[model samples]
Target: MSPGPGAGSAPASLTATDKVSTFSSFRVRNYRIHFFGNAISNIGTWMQRIAQDWLVHELTGSAAAVGITLALQFLPMLLFGLYGGVLADRVDKRKLLIGTQAALGLTGLTLAALTFTDVVNVYHVYVLAFLVGLVTVVDNPARQTFVSDMVGPRLLRNAVSLNSANFQSARLIGPAVAGVMIAAVGGAWAFLANGLSFIAPIIGLLMMRTSELNPAERVPRGRGQLRDGLRYVGGRPDLLWMIVLVGFIGTFGYNFAIWLVAFTDQVFASGPGTFGLLNSLMAGGSVVGALLAARRGSNRTRFTVGAAAVFSSLLVVASAAPNFVVFAVLMPLIGLAGMTFQVTANSTIQISSDPAMRGRVISLFMMVFVGGTPIGGPLVGWLSDEFGARVGLISGGLVCLAAAVGVALILARIGGLRLRISLRAGSRGLALVPRDPEEVTAPAGAAIRPVA
Candidate 1:
């Protein structure tokens, strides 16, 4: 059914043709187009990522070298993410996306040319990867804030969850496709496909009707906008804590993909086919986790904290798996927990932020979640090189566990909830001690609130 001449065109309204009832965010025609385009493009992106890492490993046979490649790819994100956020605020996101995507497509084509011509080396791959990462520094913030412009606050949670679902679904397919392509047509073909894939997003960006977008008050670029953004985030304890926890997880624990590549290649002596399978398995689980999150209404603090804890525990389990089959089976659990944690964190931050400052807050979130990859990749790579990939995986899991525990305790203290563990009927629950129990007012016949 066609939308009645701007009848179903509100930023927060469901369109006439949306299939998913629960995910009302897709009702927006522009976001639906954006989502589908991103889904296709992300598949190619993941294909390139897998092929790139494999190519680097094939050339140098060093985990540290792979880490260096990852660092080069992400270093721009660490340095310029805040500036990118400022840019997002100052410019039209739709236009910014077009420019970034075009640049990224050119970079992919360049790599494809090098690979197809048999002139590609590790150095060339590193340089191209760094260039692509630079584009992403701007692209990530623009894309994130763009979702709000598409759907507004009402369905933002659902939109974020659906975005994760799209990403994970691509994750499940892209590597497998890349693996087949690599074996048959070679890595160059995968790169070419990635370059071509950018066309979908470019088309989506062009197709969007600009007048329908929710326009935030554009803050003019001037003195201290960066500082103001920082201060705004710092003042909100919830947002601050959320970003910090995500950073800790991203830096120390959430980088299983890179570690998984090394573990499969070096430890298990598995080929790209096996590596692709592991990634697909994890992505399959992530798809499930993301859909479940989409169904759940709103993001809560406890959900964020609990998901992190569960994610860390699953990582420990995945790290201890004895063989490739066991590890593959554990991949889904790891992906489920990890995606849930991330979706919860992303949604909470988006919903809590003011519209005018949403770009900066979302950029900070991206910085912590993605920018930390440069530092963590190198550290994990060094660990894999020195102590073995298993040690790198295990150490990362432990760090995640420690961070989750520490953050939980800190939040509990700040929220004035005394943390106590009690086993009731073979299940554990947290007991709360309110700071002023007598002063705590409750509606008549209401039960006491339980601490998470």
Candidate 2:
């Protein structure tokens, strides 16, 4: 369970006793700029998401059609994600991100123009979504690893947690704003706003001080690097199982876009405002979970597995809620658990992998995390179409719950750890403790570092 090749040395400044700042990464001017720029961009991105899904749903009046839109958008990632990761490892990350970001913005603008002209169709939406996905194949991996370049290893976990907080915090606004704009002006305005929001991130990337960044050693042009990355991950049990677990949860459990629309239209018979409210409530929970993770400052497999279990279980319960209020009550808790699981898994993999292989590793992670939307979205849409939205949601939750249990058992067996549940008054309760206390402390993946 040793760290895979290129697990760079711990930052020299980090120590056991250093007080961890919840916003430590903000101390760095570079990360601060990156944070604020992405914040604005993320809001726009969420707004576009709301508008796009609503547009597709409105045009076709079928949940399956919305699923198809999501499928097309993510199909490129399934097809070319590994190659994107390889490219990310070779190129200047900052420069590559700027290009991808600009391309994404243009796609938004093109969609806006077509909609404004009154000639937009579902096919146009599908094509534009696919184009955005193509850019994201490169953008996601580059953006993920760039945090390392911005703040170095010392504040990586905190920075990563804050990044989630940033996205979710924007989620708190994006859907509400998009809902209002869609009701007042049109989806076209939302698209236009999204396209313009790209300017902020592009400017932020330009404003960065290159000298202060901690760039990884860029891999030179070569063949077989993709295979090499796959092999590297294959040889590590920790990385493999963690990625598998996330793949299941992300693909099956995280199709909120599809499910929310289905529920709003079919079950609740509500409009975009309710949909926006639902998303905002969940986002509020996500923002809280991410900030809590930032404060917690340590990653452990048990915590991740537990969070996944809680998240998936909540999904199951939510599907059975008797009314909108009951369903809405669960959204924030689901968001909290889901975000906790995500931030923990993401930071763990990022920190544990060799720096040289980070892009590929992260790409593989993103590939499964988002790329599976193509496969799951359509199927879930069909289920919602055939049976009911509740059935579709509950099925996905069951799959995720099963996957979490399976992964936990696999990791426990591999690590020779057993589940321990304490009933003592002062006990924190459930944990995974090594069967042989004398055995060498669990592998690097299971090791803990105090956040600083």
Candidate 3:
């Protein structure tokens, strides 16, 4: 039976193979609904982002205000992201998501109402931002792990990349739309639109056929679960290094909101219009990067570290661009590199963690990845205030570059991974050969199978 040419050519196999080649996650019916709906919501999310930043800038001519708002939004994550992950491990993720999304919409409406009534102040923005952050502390981890339920492990990499693509694809449009909308109407309209966009995700969630979901085993109520989650991640050096590298970049490198404001106000002397356009340009590049990553196979640690180094270098170069046009043109390239690094880091961590521990691990990863914002945002803001926008950006980039170099050296020494030339046919470049324990006494050329 297995000898026939057509034996393995079932329609399901053909479909799955086709899916793996391009935006493969879309093959799942539930994921397709979630994807499109989430994309719509993300567009609104970006619009709110631009609107909030610009509104704060207009209210107070301080870059720090914008930073403070961002800080408050993420501060909740800083405080609760781990616990949120713990909670995610023990709950129905979809039901939890419904509640968080609804709450977030209310937060947006609160801001919108305040704005429309002409009483929207910086403090008001800060309050609503905190509220939004509270919802996100729960939402981020659940959403991160929920992808696993939707598509299963085999397509997780493609699904993660597509999720980012969905986000960045909206990013490509959102800022541009926000800029025009803010100029035409006011930031309130953008906030209102964001509030309404929540409906789509809610609808998507409700419509999902629950029986198709591959739910993970939930952790029962227990005393030492948090410690167990931490211990689980603490045991994996690869996960540790990935988290640390990304933590550094997230803290220092991803302070675009601060830097973009500084450039618009101080360096370029532009308005909200230009600022929004700059964001759009950056996101357009990110869309390209995410799509390219979607086309990639397994998420490799080597690729992750290398991408970070390149991303850091690009940031350093971008910091020195001579003029606004040059800076604007350079943004897309920087976005491409940054997205590549982030997508790799994200997919790598998600795919590598154990299913039982995935929620908690992703929560920890998200905590570091985004929770660093409270420290980094205000610090980068102050740096922008004290020195200059260009210097602030350069400083962030340099820190990232140094982190990349340091991590690479440390991991190479610890893993016994040395660079070697492979003269085998068509594989002539330098490659990392992980020395296997069985072949510990052998030279590089007498390679046993490279360690996983």
Better of 2 and 3 by TM-score: 2
lDDT of 2 by residue, 1-452 (tens): 23223233333344546767788878778889999999999999999999999999999999999999998999899899998899888888999999999999999999999999999999999999999999999999999998988877767889999999999999999999999999999999999989999999999999987766777888988889999999889878888899999999989998999999999989999999999999999999999999999987677787898899999999999999999999999999999999999999999999889989999999999999999999999999999989999999999999999999999977886777777899999987987777775643534554333211
Query: Considering summed lDDT, which 10 consecutive residues are worst modelled in model 1?
Result: 1-10
* Candidate 2 or 1, higher lDDT: 2
Clashing pairs in 2: 6-354, 7-354
Count of clashing residue pairs in every prediction: 0, 2, 0
- By TM-score, the candidates rank as 2, 1, 3
Error of 2 at 183 (Å): 1.0
- Reference-based TM-score of each model: 0.92, 0.92, 0.91
The sequence of per-residue lDDT tens digits that candidate 3 reaches over residues 166-246 is: 998888888889999989998999999999999999999999977667677777878988889888877777777778998
lDDT order, best first, reads 2, 3, 1
Per-residue error at 149 for model 3, in Å?
A: 0.2
Candidate 2's C-alpha runs over 4 A off are 1-17, 420-433, 436-452
Q: Write the per-residue lDDT of candidate 1 for residues 279-374, one digit (tens) a residue.
A: 899999999999999888765687788899898887777777888889889889888989999998998888778876888898899888888888
Ranked by TM-score, the better of candidates 1 and 2 is: 2
lDDT of 3: 0.84
Give candidate 1's error at residue 112 in angstroms: 0.2
Q: Distance from true position, residue 54, model 1, in Å?
A: 0.5
Residue 228, candidate 2: how far off, in angstroms?
0.7
